[model samples]
Target: MDSGVELKKFGLPSQCCECGPQKSPALCSAIFATSICPNCFGMSVTPGTRYHTLLNTNEPPDESELTFVRSVASTVDASLEYLDHEIANLPENVKRLEEKRASLLSYRVRNNAILSPLRRIPPELLREIFSWTMPSLEGTAEVALCIEQTPWMLTQISRRWRVVTFSTPSLWSQIFIDYRHSHINRDPSTYSPSLMKAQLDCAQKLKIHFYGSQGIDLRPQIDMFKLLSQHSSRWEELSVELTAEMVPILMTLRDRIPSLRRLWIQWSTVEDQTGVHSIDCFQTASSLVDVGIFNDYRFVPVLLPVHQLTRYDMDCQLEEHIRILKQTPNIIEARIDIAFDEEVGSDSLETVDLLGLRRLYISPAGVLKYFKVPALEELALDIYGEDILSLVRSLLDRSSCSL
Candidate 1:
């Protein structure tokens, strides 16, 4: 036979069982064996296996492919076993380590807490820290919890922080319970007393603010004042803004709080013109060295009995205050509120009759005409709605003639 005809007669066709005469077969398998055609066998196992076990023909494995496959299989097996062991032990190990870290932190905090450092510092230095932490006047808003909000920064650092916060009386002092801007409206009855007592115990100065709450009847003020009266000796300063009707309850506190030094009793800015009659609360602040009374022209004369006051401010009929200046002997500083006129007159000069007065502030329309001012040191005059040059000229003339 011819050479080509004899080769075709002996050769096997390239088709496989997996290919099934449709597509190229990378592999074909049975229970006993897996076979790949020479064209596709590279896709299945390596050439090394082909020579050793797969093929009855004479082709052999490429040595490089055999070495790569053996190394890959060993690595894959080792990785799987190692991953299993790591997954099995991870959670328990994490829990144990977390517990140990928590214990260590707790020990560190307790050992290094604020109390020890606080105790070691001198009392004067401690007082300065107390002063530094004290809250400034927060206008009409509710007092924000500056230290309480920053508990983590100071308190969580060590055991000493907690001790210092609790032990330092000055730190806890000056609790401002401003019911005006608080959520106190939701349950006023239940909440007011508790806050009052807590603040009273912790603070030496108390500021009870009542902002924009018409619903807060006088009963709450009375109750809180009663509670504060119980701790009167510690109450050093008080700033109260209440309805004109709450004056009675506040006056009850005057005798009880022997330690009270400063008292500010004023009406609401919004509720300025509500009541026809004015009530006086200043007479009760006997220990008061500073007082501010806000009233209409018709209401200021009744409070002149508080003559022992060091500082006094009144928004009332300025002419009516002449009687007050005539009576109160030790008036150090006085601010009298009244409309002024340009004309220099005897009545206007008589208004500042506090002979021992050191500081005097008069309003825009007030005319200081004639007076015997012996100890008058600082005088402030507000001259509005008038000819500025003429007013100054008349003042200079009067000042020269008086001298």
Candidate 2:
């Protein structure tokens, strides 16, 4: 037998029993079990001499081929009917599965809501956790970002959280106002009066920091100062860095800051040679016990309540440093950074006796020989000049105090 003829016999029929014969001739149903005609199946011969002899002839088989094809047609029809019935029920089966999946998901969500751990935390403890989110009111930029981050974020979480955050006064007590760089370009009217009032209303004691950049107009700063000055009695600490033009506005608060305990001020770099402009307003601040002055050469001398001050930090010339110390006889701690422009004539200067001084930090150790701190227990000298060791030894011997 030809190999091509054997290979052709293995090919699938162009037509099957379910659809009857197609335009192409029907395949012999004897070799294939699936979709075979009954007549073709009866005509199929066993793999022997009979099958080989049938392949050799070109003529078709007689009644046996017709009977086999008819029989196969009946069997295929019955099988297709069973498959159609199963396929017809698939939509109902799919609908039931989708419903079960939805039910399971809903039940899981309900169970999770009932078991949520956050609902178990007490209100007081929750408020304390929110409080910790507030940034420390030290640096200028950090404090500005904190206003929008902590209190605002907490209020947005829930109604109860908003009430708790607003009731907590300490969160709003520290206020930092910086008008440096781009911040100075904003319109003064845009500053929120309501927000400022809310902070003032809630806080018992306020710590205010107001900083200004060079070349910025003092008009906006003066307006801000006016608003803050209204509540000066509540200010516990005030730090202001302003231009020389803004000093007069600050001096307006001298007698008004009755509750102020600490004050820090820095003037613009422009030198004040007349020595006539002084911050005499703070002279009446009875509660003012600590004072810090920076860039003193740029401003007229600042007049502080020196006799009542327990701590003083002065960045000034040696003459001004001596002048402030001589007035502050009750100072217990002092940090002095002397400017190098002027030399101190020790022979012409009188010795300042700081009887209550316990801690002293001084740069250009040559200044130590000018002070008589008998009660000094802690001393830090910035060893910048020659004879620092000798100066310290002389200070130790003159005070007659143990190191």
Candidate 3:
């Protein structure tokens, strides 16, 4: 190796035998520059990085340096032994550090519980937040018949939350129960009356949705319907689709549902065939405003306080819908799928003016001429591509409304 390169690598003086270890690099350089032999520059009294350079500077080491070579070899062996001993303790050291880290993490979680943001929220405010998460029973949206969810789940949080949910009457007032929740062999207790009884007892003004099919031995559902019907005075809305003498049972509560406002009724019969039942069970409901009757296959004429209705969604013939719209001039939204043996010609169909109607969803767009919706804002028509432009233009122009 070159002397200058060796000097930078070790940060040490390129010493001679005469110039000792205590001498500075500058002193050594000056001593070497003035020395008689420039070849003896790298020889040092003690071992350093320059010592290796000294050994490789010329030929092999002389016999006089054998003892010094053995001393350096022994020093390297002792250093290796010390490092290996330290490496053996590494696993124990890592285990202790990991234990400390885990303990500190758990301590932080425990301490955070006292000042958690959930703890800061009041019980009434939490109840309000929960109401938005739960489904609204008044609408047509289907809700699952699970007791281990929502308001029930909220009560399981803690004692304070349980008391809060139990005290909130609105949380328990709305329920949607289906007959399929019960299985004779698998889980018969799924739709037990005891659960409904507890739910009804906690509820105030109720919005109940009861759905049951035909020929399923809907004994549990019937029992539940009987339980819910007892609280008919508290009813604010009823979406009924059940069988097994549900009609006569509901008939007893004709005038009793005074607080009822909205109704969705669908009659069920043998083998899923739409049964004909003249349902006026909810007719005397004084506060009723919204109504929907499923009449796609068979139209069961529902006698409602039609003049006060704000919304009507019925699947009936054109003539029948026109007859209903005549009674419901105040209807704001209408979704009518007209069933027919023959389409009614625009000239012969009666034009009913619904000045208050804002949204109209009609199937087969050909029936647009029957209603003159002057205040129409949203029109949903089901038709093919070619007939769209003409039908829509005619409806908009004839209605004389900005849609």
Candidate 4:
């Protein structure tokens, strides 16, 4: 609107005029430094300000000038329409995504400001948070513990985040009882039973692995067993990897735990026990439903006494093993690892009479011997020579056995 700045003409087409129609000769200079219609100065142009500089310099109307207003109007209308559709169709999705983003940012801020200063937090809260995010039955206990110890970024940023982290019970639930996955040596005495007891006090399932250097202490093993016995009422699953010294404790647990539905035991060393002393420990646990056992010796068949057991797994290769396993009346599935015996005459042993067995695994040796087993969905063998393969073929010839 300054007087010194003469409004020049931007000689555009009549259709591009600011006003509907013009009467005077178009000077074709911009009124200001805008793409303005020259006939009626800038007043007759569209609502947007236009430059006069281009027309004064003999330049044609820019493509930007031609379409800017219309395109802007179209974009605005389209945006409003899109907003309306999105509000109706995907409101929750948009809201959740935005909230997640906000949560991430808030956590970052908190980590930078608060939790870094106060290193330790209440055990309960730490355990709870860990329970929410820690890998469930997937990761090793060490890795899960390390992840739980990872500092909350938001807590590092401010006091409020630290307070929230400290107060939340979910944070503490992350502390789980890891008996099987955590590294355990011969000295069960060295284990922190109190800490484990506190964390897994309410746990429904527990997996414990036990190994030894030369031998294990009987007393500590008994103490550990006592701890398990105390909490056995709530236990739903139990997996125990045992050494020879832990037999007494293992045997005692059958009577103590009434709620156990699943049990897995792998006995590495039996301390050269014959059937005389071993049979005393065999007690039929009625509640036992699923059982997997890895026995080193063929003479001991402790788990076979559980007649009510429905599922059984034995990773052993004894020829007469199935005879013991046949004691389980209701067993619908049995996975037995059997070793081959070449010296034993193929005709001496009777055919397997597992009337209820739907699954069986026989070593290549067992396949070689003239054998009749019940209909099995799966069978595997360790083949040493062509004789074994021939035996397998001969056995499968009776039925089409696919690997």
Maximum-lDDT candidate: 3
Query: How well is each residue in 85-170 modelled by candidate 2, as lDDT tens digits?
Result: 76898798789888999999999998897787766778789878877887775454545623366666787876777878788877
Q: Any runs in candidate 2 off by more than 4 Å, and if so which?
A: 1-131, 137-139, 145-147, 183-191, 271-276
Cα lDDT listed for each candidate: 0.53, 0.71, 0.73, 0.51
lDDT tens per residue, model 4, 118-236: 44655465546545653454454443323234333334645655666545534333332333422534324345666446445534444433332224345655566567656665555
**Candidate 3 all-Cα RMSD:** 10.2
Best of the two (1, 2) by TM-score: 2
Alpha carbon lDDT at 35, candidate 2: 36
Total backbone clashes of model 1?
Answer: 11
Off by over 4 Å in 4: 1-190, 205-221, 268-276, 279-282, 315-319, 329-332, 339-346, 367-374, 386-389, 397-403
Cα lDDT of model 1 by residue, 1-403, tens digit: 4422321232423344345676422233231122223333324333443332424555555675465335334544554566688899999989999999999999998788655665587656654664565546655343543334322134454465555554555555564544455466564554346644554565545444333245555567556655655675666676666555555555555456666677665555436435535444445656777767665423523352457877777765545556566667788887776533233345334534455667767665334543335566776778767665665455545444331
Task: Say which candidate scores most in TM-score.
Answer: 3
Comparing 1 and 4 on lDDT, the stronger one: 1
Give per-candidate clash totals: 11, 14, 0, 52
lDDT of 3 by residue, 1-403 (tens): 5544544443333553344556544453353332122323344323555456556667565576555455445544554565687799889989999999999999999899888898879877988997886876544334555677678888888888888888988988877876543343355456667767888888888988888766466666677788888999999888888463687687788788889888887766543434535767777888989988885456667788889899999878888888889998689999988775464445777788998999999887887877788899999988844388888888889989888
TM-score of each: 0.58, 0.68, 0.69, 0.50
Stronger candidate by lDDT (1 vs 2): 2
TM-score of 1: 0.58
Q: How much does candidate 4 score in TM-score? A: 0.50
